[model samples]
Structure formats: C-alpha cells, structure tokens
Target: MAAAPSGPVGPNPPVIAVVGPTGSGKSDLAVHLALELDGEVINADAMQFYRGMDIGTAKISVAERRGVPHHLLDTMDVTEEASVSAFQADCRAAIRDIHSRGKRAILAGGSGLYVRAALDVLEFPGTDPAVRERLEREHAQAGLRPLQERLRSVDPVSADRLGDARRVIRALEVFELTGRPFSSFMPSREYFQPAVQIGLDVDRDVLRDRLAGRVHRMVDAGLLAEVARLDAAGLRRGKTASRALGYAQFLKVLDGESDTASAAEETIVATRQFARRQLTWFRADPRIHWLDWQDPDLVAKAAGICASPASVI
Candidate 1:
C-alpha cells in the first residue's frame, strides 16, 4: 500500500491527476477537485513553469485558483530549459509535502510526458552536454531534415512522434549516448505512486470550435503583448520556451514573417493539432478515467472518484 506523505498512515489517499487536451477545462476541473477534496495542485504543464508565460498558457489566475494552494507554476525563468527529470523530482516532493499536510495532491496539465514522469515509474536517460552540442551543431548546419532522417532510421517510433527539430535532435543525442533507441527508454504502464487520472473528453467538432474561440480570446487578452514582453526578456534564448504554441507563432510576427491575424490563425491550427496529439497520448493509457467536459455534474463526479477508495487505487 502507498504511504501518505506524512508517514506510514492507515490508508494513504491517492494523488489525483487532471489531464486532457489544451482547451478541455482541465484547469477548472482541477481547481474544483482541489477545493472539494482539500487538495493542492502540482503543475504538469511544462510551458506553465516559465514565470512570465501566463495568458498564452491559460494558467489559472490567483483568483481562479479558488484559495487552493498550487505548486510548480512560475518556477522557471523564460531562458531556462524545462527538464522532465527535474520536474519528476520536484513533483514527487510537492506531492509528499501536500500529503504531509493531510491534503491530496492534484497533478494537473495537458503535458503527457511531464505527467507520466511525475506519476509513473518512468526513468529519464542521462544527458551529455558534448553529445547535445554536437547534435545542436549538426541541426544548425544541416537543418532538421537531415537530422530527422537520421532519427527516423534509428528510432522510427520517436521519429513519428516528434515533429519539432529540437526533440528530434534530442532523441538522436540519446541514441548516440546510450547505443539504444530513444523509444527503448519509454516506461511501461506502472504507477510510481497510488494515483487516479481523470481525463476530460470532448467531441472533436466542438473541441475545434472551442479551441478557435479560445485562441481568439487569448489574442484579445493580449497574447501578442505577452509574447512581446517575453521576447524582450530573452525568450528566444530559451530552448523550450521559445517553441511554445502561441509564443512561436507570435515570434514569427515579430520577425516580419507573419501578421497578428495570421499568427492567431496559425496558433489555432497548431493548438488543434496539439490537442489531437494530447488525446492520442492520454487515450493510450488505459488507466485514465475519462469524463465528458460538458457534464453538468462534473465536479461532483470527479469528487466521487476522489472519495471512492476502489476507484482511486
């Protein structure tokens, strides 16, 4: 049996994970669950970790958090690399701390790997700066196509999964360092702790409309201005932060390659694609209990999952 973070207790409450696509109301659900269960939230969204990335990431505002304590948001500088390995350690520690205080730990976000790293028996491969630098140099000199081809030849699974050049390079670096395919390091379906995952489901057509409206709302909420501020703060120097959906599109605007309207449309399209990918990732995990995003009694249903010992463990 899993022990509560406080110590060896009679029965340890399970950690709750709120997961779904980008515009699927996971944040609101997480807050509701936290309030209902006396829980704290640990962020699994990799982008939300950057201190100044608020509006575009749809980070829950202080007022929206509903008096529930949240951990791991705004934890990194715009120029720092977000590491899954580091997040795993920090998340486990946060869960333990919340448990010590006799509150449940709610892990919330759409980031699949980050969530898995936190709650599953996943081990990250070691990184070598020399290898990474070589891959970076190759990418800079030869572009993504050549490196992507190399990754395709070596790790076809990762090649199919990774669309961005940075990830492709990273996968190649891992293969070079370990003499093993990057996919070989993928974790089996085993929980690192007693946990329950609640995934939000939505119809694809409705989700597309919702995502488009959300992108428009974000733009109206000053997403361009937010990107401007981060750009000034050396956002381009950050390997991970620079590639965030909204941020990347707007950066093209700043570079005179796109306009605000076009960037908004591009972001919407990219987000829709990303949402599909997120669904693919979470749906593959048979462990997640899916709930419809539009359910009228959403909070109560999720709360039931938290309260039921059989459903949780």
Candidate 2:
C-alpha cells in the first residue's frame, strides 16, 4: 500500500472539497481524508442541512463519522428553506474556524451551486420582494410557459439552463432587479480562497445501478417513516426541503397517492437523473482533480493531492 501523504502543512491550507454525484461515496472518502489529513468535514450537501433528514439523505451517522469533527449538518429545521447565500456565509465561517485551529477544511457534497459558492469567487444578487412577488403572481396567473418565454427573451443563457419554475421565475426576477442577465452573476473559475476540488468519477452504468439500489435501501431503512415524521413537522411548508428527491416522492405515499414500492422506484429514477445533472455541472469545471471512485488508494491519492503544493489553486 502507498504511504499516506504527510498532509498539508502551514496554518492556512487550501480548502479541500470532495464533489461528485450522489451514490459516489463522497462522504466516506471525505471522512477518510479528514482522518488522514487531520482535518474537519464541512457539508455542502444542501439536504443534509435539515435536522431529521438523515435516512433519505444518507447523512453520515455520528458513529460512521469515525470521530472526525463535522460542521453544518442538521443545522436547520425541516420547515425552513435552505439558502445558498446563507450557506456561503456559514461555510466560509466554518472554513475560517477550521483553518484557525491549524486543520484543513474538507467540503463534501454534490450541490454544484453550493460548492461553487464556497470555493469560487461568487456573489449573490439581492432579491427584491416586490419584483419577486410580481413575477410569482404572473407565474400563478399565466403559468410557467409565459414566464419561461419572458426569461428566454431577456436572459437566454439562464433560460436554457434553468428547468424548474422556481428558478425560471428567479431568473426573471434578477433581470428585472439588476437589468443584467442572471447568468452574468455566475461565479468565474477563479477561486475565492485557495482551494482544491476533488471530483469522483464513476462509470455511468455502474452509477445508475448503484443509485437504484441505494434508493431501495433507503426505503427499506425506513425512509417513508422518516419522511412522515418530517411531514408532521411541517416539511411541506418548506419550499426547498419539500422538493428533495426521496422526500418529495415518499410524501405522495403518505398522501395515499402512491404506494411504497412505486415511491421507491420514482425516487430511484429521480436520483439517477439528479446524478446525471451533477456530473454535467461538475464536468464543466476545469479545476477539479478527478479520481476513480473504485480506486483502492483513493484516500491516499486524495491526501497526496492535498499535500502537493501544486494542487492548491
């Protein structure tokens, strides 16, 4: 076996982020790297922010963490929406705290925007409630197609990229607020802080099968019950949490609109699609050093990357 790299030295090592699609073993690899590098893990997975969203999200258990300190898990209630702007502040604070203690900070998740917000030179545009409210009203009155068409007219790039109604509406709102294309605000490849992103590369065929099986396992592990518990806690009131992959589908089961088997299958399909989107988003970034997900020396290789001065961006 290869020897572990001595790990990054000096008081302010670059932030390390493990990023890839769901079911790519990012959390386990992050924990291993944290143990090897004497670092702490900070979550970038938006869903993992909720307090009771464990089973469906596959959040690492306290024991599974292997005693490495983790930050930003379960920091919000189910009824609250997860905010990328808020997360940017919180994530930066965590990174500062970890670096102050002379330890590396490892950010692990597949949330592309959240990952970029933490590591890249990104700035969020402020929202205007009046504009947002007006756009939302237009959406409700005229439906999504009209708003999507309007966004395409003003910001074609964002129009082409955004799929959901909420994002499309948000794009329109941004255009009205700033007279600038929402895409103009996208973070450039430049790092906001010294950082390195390690991406996990998995074969699409293998990843598809793995995601299907993982969704089934989550259901068998009582994901439905977990969703029920959160729903009772007003999860449906949450704009973001209500739409999460497994939680959304399982809520239909709770509503008598679907069965457990059907919900599990839907969750599997949705997860696979989500993983594809994640791959697409991460692949566009040229800086991520991708390692084979199946590599036996994955942690050692990642630690080696951390220790190498050249890996710092």
Candidate 3:
C-alpha cells in the first residue's frame, strides 16, 4: 500500500478520481465513496459517455447509482466522437457545479487520458480544416511513411510516439498551426485544480479472470443485441464508438464474419490486453494512491485520504 497523496489545500475540496483497469470495481467503489462523502460522480470513462452503450461499457445502472447524481454519462449519441478537449471543459464545469452545491466531485473511470485532461494542466491545440485536409490528402496520396518522415523532421518525439496515421496527421497539423511541437502540448502532472487520485490495484491473474468473466456476462446480458441496435443507429459511421472493445467484435458477428461465441472470446482477449495497457498507464503516475481492490476497508481508507490536509501548492 502506497502512502496517500496530500489532499486539497484551497477553498474547494479536491476532485476525487477513482482510477483502474476495467472490472476492478471502480464504479462500485466510486458510488460507495460518493455515498460516504456526500459527493456526485462525474464520469471520466470516454466510452460511458455515449447513450445506449450501457451493457458493453458496463455503465452503472440508475438503480446502481443509488440516487447519487452521476454527471457526463450517457451525454452523447453513439455517432459523435469522444473529444478529450470537449470533455475537459464539460468535466471541469461539472466539478464546479458540484462544488458550488457543496458536494465533493468524484471522478471514476479507466480512460487515463480523459482522467488527466480533467485534472491536469493540459492544453488542446486548435485545428484548421484546410491544414487537416491537406495533411489527410498527403497521407492518402503518399502513404503514412511520407507523413511519418515529414513529422519526424519537424517533431521527432511526436513522430516516435504516435503510431497511427490519424494521430500522426493530427500531430503534423498541430505543428503547422501552432509552430510548436505536438509534444509541447502534452500534459504535465500539474493539476488544473486541487485533486486526489485513488487507484484500484488488482492482482494481474485475478484481474484477468475478472475481465474474462465480465465479458462473458456482458455477452449473456445482450451485448450483441445492444451492438445490433447501435449499428442500426450509425455506429459504424462513428470513428470512436464503433471500435469499442466488444462492439467491434460483435459487429463482426452482425456481418457474418464471426459467431457470437467467437466474438465473446475475442472481446475477452482484447479486454484483458486493454486492462494490461491501463495498468501500465496508471502505474506510471506516482501521484495515484493505490489501494487493494478487495480491501474490506477500501472506502474508509479512501475517505480518510480525502479528509487529510494536503501540502499547500
């Protein structure tokens, strides 16, 4: 068990973020903390933002929320892209609203960047349509190698970091628009506001079993039906939502390229892989106070951390 990070120092209470890999019970723990602390939950999970994505996303149900208000969940249609910049604004606003009402703001999710965007001193560069279009055209005409070379010339760090053509193009576009390396815009650990992050640490073998069982349960809970319904609603047109873990695999089932059993297995594998990546991402953050996911005193420990006085920043 790591020592808890210092708590909030100013007039407002700290934004409490419960972070971990999927199937680590972050949602349930957040709800419990909210009940204990008189807080409202503001979702940091990007996938949970879309409406009708409940089953696949494992979104907390209304009854499960237990009358503690949850903000930002089900706020977007499946057709809309989940924008971190937009989410940063909305999440900050939600925090302010919760604070003004004298409630603690509890953020819960596995999406690392989204969690950071809400809590860190991150700036998003503006984009120009013409510049983006030109980059896209160049990528299409000459392939990713040429664009990769171009980006390598201007911003080698971003070039090395970004893998896909879309992100690489966006990196180039940012450099063209801002005359700055895309790496310069990357978030620092400095918080935008006072915040405390509590991470759920689960044993790797245990998490693997949990993720597999969760995927199977999701399939049994009509995940394929949910995907079919969303597919009918322009899901494939949406760049982000269409590629969600289970939704993507189940779409293969819908297209006759796979069976439900195969999709479920694939989803389980992909989800476990994603969980590993999530662990890697969160493990790098020293500020996160990690707790055993199965700790019987988890909520009590978390609330105590929240109550402790923080070092003045």
lDDT of each: 0.89, 0.92, 0.90
Which is the better candidate, 1 or 2, if ranked by TM-score? 2
Q: Write down the worst ten-residue block by lDDT for model 3.
A: 1-10
Name the candidate, 2 or 3, with the larger TM-score value: 2
TM-score of each: 0.93, 0.96, 0.94
Clashing pairs in 3: none
Clashes of each: 0, 0, 0
> Judged by lDDT, which candidate is best?
2
Candidate 2, residues 1-313, lDDT tens digits: the string is 4445645566667899999999999999999988888889999999999999999999999999999999999999989978899999999999999998888899999999999999988988888889888888988898899988898999999989998888998888888888999999999999987888899999999999998888888988999999999999999999999999999999999999999999999999899999999999999999999999999988888889987889888
**Candidate 3 per-residue C-alpha lDDT over 208-311 given as tens digits, one digit per residue, 9 for 90 to 100:** 99888999999889999999999999999887899899999999999999999999999999999999899999999889999999999998888787767652
Judging by lDDT, tell me the better candidate of 2 and 3.
2
User: What order do candidates take by TM-score, descending?
Assistant: 2, 3, 1
Report the error of model 1 at residue 14, Å. Answer: 1.1
lDDT of 3 at 108: 97
RMSD, one per candidate, in order? 3.6, 1.5, 3.1
Clashes of 1: 0
lDDT of 1 by residue, 40-105 (tens): 888899999999899899999999998989999999999999999999999999988888878888
Candidate 3, residue 295: lDDT = 95
